[model samples]
Target: MGLLVKGKWYDKWDYNNDEGEFIREESQFRNWITKDGSAGPTGEAGFKAEPGRYHLYVSLACPWASRALIMRSLKGLEDMISISVVNTLMGENGWTFEEEEGVIQDPVIHADYLYQIYTHVEPEYSGRVTVPVLYDLKQNKIVNNESADIMRMLNSAFDEVGANDKDFLPENKMTEIDEINEKVYGTINNGVYKAGFATTQEVYEKEVTTLFDALDDIEERLEHSRYLVGDEITEADWRLFTTLIRFDSAYHGHFKCNIKRIVDYKNLWRYTRELYNEPGVKETVNFDHIKKHYYRSHKQINPNGIVPKGPELDFSLDK
Candidate 1:
């Protein structure tokens, strides 16, 4: 992992001495593409919804990036907006375009590294170059890098252009969906990182316990409801589902979030399987890419970089 300091690349992991916590910095771009071509919370108005106007840069391994990819496929925006997959193993230069197995090369600019795209957008851009970047093909700039915002755009913005059938974030369920998203994002989604990257044992124990506590709560909540907010599959369910799908497979062992495997939680496990079986959802997941990225990339976590082959998950076979 690397970050840009005054537009210069520096290969270093995140650190926070004051709090003794692995604090994740918020994404810089937070724009949206509405139907009316209006400006979002940030950025300009030229990023209007148009066919072949946008291209998404993502990694199949990343849950955050996977969220956008899922939305794109479900919304039927595949033809409207193109995509590029970065190599899963984020190395000294962070996300790169080194073609290896399933890692898709940068087709838009043919850049050697993903950070090159950031520098292309803004020479002085200073932040972590994260995935799920919505690039404006017409303007040749990053529309938004925030996955949450990109999900919203993919959910609604391109209705007139195409994919007008599916509405992941229905208006009636907005409030409930938002509430679910908040809980999942904080506790379960980012909780794995909180537990894994904890500098102290005390911090790790606190986060791991909190992570499972939230999982238990969700497992209980999912007992009656088919989805997080209601019987209908909404944005909230998709958001939480991504993390749950990755829980036992990656987070449990690699991230040291080993309180209990997600498979042990009956409701969560079934719910995860249900989501994974959804139309176009399963295609977004690339387990080989996901597993290799985590095990090999984080040398500190897995010093030998020898990827594991067991645990025998059957997510690929139909539920």
Candidate 2:
């Protein structure tokens, strides 16, 4: 992992805090793209939705980035908003589009590295360069880099341009969806990273325990409810889906989140396959990219960088 220091690249991976907990950096580009070029819930305005006017830079290996890709596919926005997937392995250069299998080189800005795109938006930008970035072609600026916000944008922002009307964030379940998102985001989504990147054993134990506790809670909830919010698949379910899909393959081993594999949870494993089988969902998942990235990228964790090949997954769901 690396970050840009005032438009300059720096190879670094010090994400731990004084307490040895891995703290995720807040996304710097918070601007939004609304349907009518109006200001969104939390950003400047004038980023109106338009076909072939926006692009996405993402990494299939990243759960956060995968959320945006899933939404784009689910909402039928593939042709509306274009995407360029970076290489799976994040090395010293940090999220490059260099020639590699399953990698789609950046065709918009033609940048070799993702940080170059960030610096192009703000020459002196200072922050961690992350994926799922929404860029405006008309305005020639970064609309938003936060996955949650981008998901909402793709849900409704381009409806006039022939995008799907399936509302992932419905009005009635807003409160419940937000509440579930909070818990899942804290525990399951970010929890694995916190555990894997923890500098001390105490922090790792605390995070891993909290992570499994959250998973157990969700497993119990899924036993009764078809989805996280209810019968309808909401933003909450998709948000959790990205992390769950990668749990057994990467987190369980590479992240040392081996308390149990996601397959060990009866309801969750079934639920995962159900979602995976959902139309347009499976296409977004690339296990080769996911495994290679986590295992090979983090040299501090696995210095030898040997990718594992066991723990075969069965993504089949019973009717």
Candidate 3:
């Protein structure tokens, strides 16, 4: 994972602490897009939700970025917002706009690397150059880089601006959704990383165990409710879906989250299939990019960088 240091590129993959635990970098840009150009829950104002004024940058390989992609598709914002797809392999230069199959060129400013977008916004910026960036062409600044925030904004902000009025995060279930999001995020969403990137065996074992425990809990819960919160699909389900969708393909073997394949759990297997069958939702998944990035990008994990070819995943397998 290369990062920008004071606006400069540094090719590094270190994410461990003294305790040998993986530490994910926090998102830097926090601005939000709202209907009235007002400040969001935790961001500044003026990033209005308007058609043809915003652009999205994402990597199909990234789960966080895929969250925003899924929300965009679910809300029917494809025509309202534009997007650029980065190359699957993130090398020394970080996320690049390299011309490749399934890769869309960066139309805004025609920058080569994703970091250029960040540096252009703030020349002296310092942080990881991540994707699923919401750019405001009018202001020429990043609206937000946090996937959760972007997902929520896409769900509601653009409704008045021609986006479909489907709210995954309903007001009545906000409290319950937030609570589930917290648990799922820590133990399942980020847990695979903690286990895969752990510098010590102790950390890996502890994280892997906790991850399976959480999966077991989710498996139990899915037996009762079709969705995470209730019978109706919500943002919580979408949030966890990104991670689960990639569990068998990337996290299971590549990230060492092999305690159980999602297919082994009857309820989770069925739920994943149900979500994948959602109209417009399946279009967002790119298994080719997902496998290549995890196996090729992380040199420290797989020094030879050999992408795997087995364990064929059929989302419709057990449904």
Candidate 4:
């Protein structure tokens, strides 16, 4: 709900005055860890891919962090890289490591707040401390916090360290992957936030209608094909799947993006169940964390902080 100013934390949530929409901050660290120790976007060299050299800081409630978790689990990098989950409900500062179920307390530095970790790397760091932070153990700094870049890094960089062989972003399909990622991010991934945090009725209507319109397009696309990109499951599918899986549970009601639930969409519903059934993917999702965080954290949206109990999701049972 807040950000750091010159390494000082503040508690201010005034993005939306009339509407309760949400606006995401830009990620700070843009560096990458390539296979040949090459520099990416930003940062110095010598970030060679090695086993047990990196750790991921994430929050289960965050879709951006969830994307990295999916890639980490699918790539079989559990042993290579460690992870710490911050509490879902962002408090005065932002993501925290409060002792809770499925939440990993800060291990390396024993810090309570996530911004502390950011300041540890750069004392004067001025930005929002977001999740899916790829920390470099050797350098004692953050390698990358951008989820899209992290997804690509996890997909390819750690092969020498025995990470999973599955390539979510195959070279031949990079063009298509990029195309789908843009649409999904604009309409679905960030669309709900635009709706929930919209400052005006016109803005909310525009975003919500766009959100459902994008969903309808995806639903129709999935009706014929098994995945978004051809029959093979690509990075695009997994990235979109996390948002769809969370739509009915959180965005539909919490974000006021209730045009229609993914459950109401025939193709999207089945496709969501299918993705949830993926071996490592399902384990990363914690509905309790997701529900409690959104409902309790955003006091502006739900003043009572009371979470609903119905709309049970049986992703495990069957289609």
Candidate 4 lDDT by residue in tens digits, 15-70: 65554455677787888898888886676777888999899999999888999999
Error of 2 at 196 (Å): 0.7
TM-score per candidate, chains pooled? 0.96, 0.98, 0.98, 0.96
Order of models, best lDDT first: 2, 3, 4, 1
TM-score for candidate 1, please give it. 0.96
For each candidate in turn, give its C-alpha RMSD to the true structure in angstroms.
1.4, 1.0, 1.0, 1.7
Per-model lDDT = 0.85, 0.92, 0.92, 0.87
Give me the runs in candidate 2 sitting further than 4 Å from their true place.
none
Find the 10 residues in a row with the least total lDDT in model 2.
310-319
Kindly give the stretch of ten consecutive residues in candidate 3 with the minimal lDDT sum.
310-319
Writing each residue's lDDT as its tens digit, candidate 3 over 1-319 gives 6898899999887678899999988898899889998898987889888899999999999999999999999999999889999999999999998988899998888999999999999999998899889999898999899999999889999999899888898899999999999999999999989999887889999999999999999999998998999999999999999999998999998989998999899999999989998999889999989998899988888889998886776787444
In terms of lDDT, model 1 sits at 0.85
Q: Can you tell me which runs of candidate 4 are displaced by over 4 Å?
A: 14-22
lDDT of 2: 0.92
Tens-digit lDDT track of model 2 for 259-295: 9998888899888998999999999999999999999
Backbone clashes under 3 angstroms, per model = 0, 0, 0, 7
